[model samples]
Target: MRVRNVRLIDGVSAQAVQDAVLECGDDGRITYAGPAARAPEPRPGVRTIDGQGGTLLPGLFDCHTHLGVPSDRSLVEAALLTDPVLGVLQTTERMKRTLDAGVTSARDLGGLPAGFRDAVAAGLVPGPRLQTSVGVLSHTGGHADGTLPGGKSLDLDYCEIADDVPGVRKAARRMLRAGADLVKICTSGGISSAHDDPDDQDLLDEEIAAVVDEARRHRGRPVAAHAQGRAGVLAAIRGGVRSVEHGFGIDDEGCDLLGERGAFLVPTLSTVFQPLDPRKTTPWRYQKKLRWNERAKENIAAAIARGVDIAAGTDAGISPHGGNLSELSYLVELGMSPMAAIRAATSASARLLGVEDTLGTLRAGYAADLVLCAGDPLRDIGLLSAPEQIVLVAQQGVVRKLTLPERSGSCQT
Candidate 1:
């Protein structure tokens, strides 16, 4: 397949290459991505996509997502009532929506069974490439704990309730044994949970360390900590987590620690900015979200200013899944150039997932995962959030979605 007459964002450069051509081989790797003048001639019978002077860039990555879980539903309701098979089907559909939104890859912090990763890899379904944590580790009454007031534990499929050091270690190992690509732990409270406030810290420091240690022992898999409070953020960093998810309460000191420790921050700006309706869940939940709404924005901006790597994540289950690209606009609002915001969702996220060499860039030899937008996102980052502006979506050289019916062409030998 060949894509021509496009402005290309290589996922690493600060500027776009005008009048570029991208050629993809059948092996699902890019053969060439360069200026049209230097591009090789199209092979016989090549499927050509005329971008019509649109923008072509690396397919985006959402560093944090929960595939099946709906943001509008209460976490407890979504966790407890859904049938296992139906849940998988629902997740499958959500994945397709995510792919249609132009995200080629994602890292699921929790709420997705790891088998789906294999399913997508085997081409049993159409979705973004997924690296799943399988389940989240939390202490009793922690954010992931869905214990009802009636004394019944939700026992959610994607949450493991483990307390103390040994229990956390065991849970981490269990997830690793179950094919988790990374370990996710709740180090702080969250907005959606009924029992804990966002300012409340959950797991013990030793417990956090144990989970991280176990993940390292398992082929050096990275650990993502669900940290939202100042104490929680610092503890996660001190415990050696690879990335801090929803770091809403990180202060200057925590930012310094993150920089020194070389940890990435997934701000989940969409979740932070999402409006809270007291009628949707509970009043306390709404209050919790309101409390950190502005503070998270400021703290994350500080982290960005500290030069700590910021990877784009929507916290999708807490927001809408297909709206993943909306996070880029938030990042731009928080002081990143449009190009840098794109990098956070592209190359930066690829590096975090340890797939930098194969994906996340429009370059020769890289996986042919690409998105064609109707306009230059640098001038208006909001273009990415508009589904109508996403002209085409290709993952691993397979065109999944294309809106430009008039521009698609087939060239003869």
Candidate 2:
């Protein structure tokens, strides 16, 4: 397929061509991506789509998400009541929204339903290219300790409780054997969990190291740690985890350590507040996210200043799944240029997931994942979140959505 008469963003440094052309083969790899004047002639019978002078960008990626949680309910409620039938149906519908929002790739940090990744890979579902972490390993009484209110303990589809070095290692291996593409370790507690403080570090150093070491043995899988506090962030880096999730408490020293360790930081900016109505959000949960609010922003700025790699994530499930691009706006608000914000959501995230060479750019031989957006994202990053603004989408050389309609719900802040 050929796309011409467009502005192209190649996902390198976010420098855009005001007008360009792109060509992709049936195998879903781009044949060329550059200026339209020097474009190669399309073979007869190869369908070519007119971009209508729209902006073509590398499809966005959400680097951290939990697909199992229902958008309309609290995490606790979803955990207690969600069943398999409901889980499958919800994932199907929820992921469509995610795809329509211009995201072609998502990394599930935890609680993605079993077999969902395979279904997406096989084209049974309309969704992003998913790399899933089956569940998170939590310490006893920690973030994902399997206990609900009233002291009742039961594991959800997304969490597994483990303790100490041996237990963490065993849990990592268990997830690896359970068809996990990546392993998630809760080195610190989080906002939605009822029994733990987000600032409290949970996993021991040995346990984190064990999980990282064991997880990487499966042909080099990446490990993401839920690290909120300074101590946990430090420990996760020291343990050699590839990325730190929800790094809300990282300071200048921690930023230096992250740069030194060559670890990526996924800051889910939406966690401090979901854009939806307050009545729709869970009680006390939003407050947990708001904890250390000022310091968190400062820390993020510090990290960026220190040249720590920043990737965009929404902590979707806890926030809203389809609003993944909103994180880019938040990044922009935090002093990143619109181009840098887009890179954080695209190429940087792809690199963090170890798919940079294949999925993140519009370069030749790269996956044909492109979003034809209506407005100039470089001028207004908020345009990216609007489904109405997304004129077309191409993932793996297949057009999944086009001729966009007015979005059902509001897409902007």
- Winner by TM-score: 1
- The TM-score obtained by model 1 is 0.96
In the range 131-167, model 1's lDDT, one tens digit per residue, is 9998998888998898876789887777899888888
Estimate, for each residue in 96-193, the C-alpha lDDT of model 2 and write its tens digit.
98999898999988888558888988989899889888888889888878676778776675677788788888888888877899899888877667
* Model 1 residue pairs with clashes: none
Clashes of 2: 0
| C-alpha lDDT of residue 177 in model 1 | 88
Runs of candidate 2 with Cα error greater than 4 angstroms are 275-286, 404-413
lDDT of each: 0.89, 0.82
RMSD of model 1, in Å? 1.7
Worst 10 residues of 1 by lDDT: 404-413
lDDT of model number 1: 0.89
Instruction: Report the lDDT of model 1 for residue 218.
Output: 85
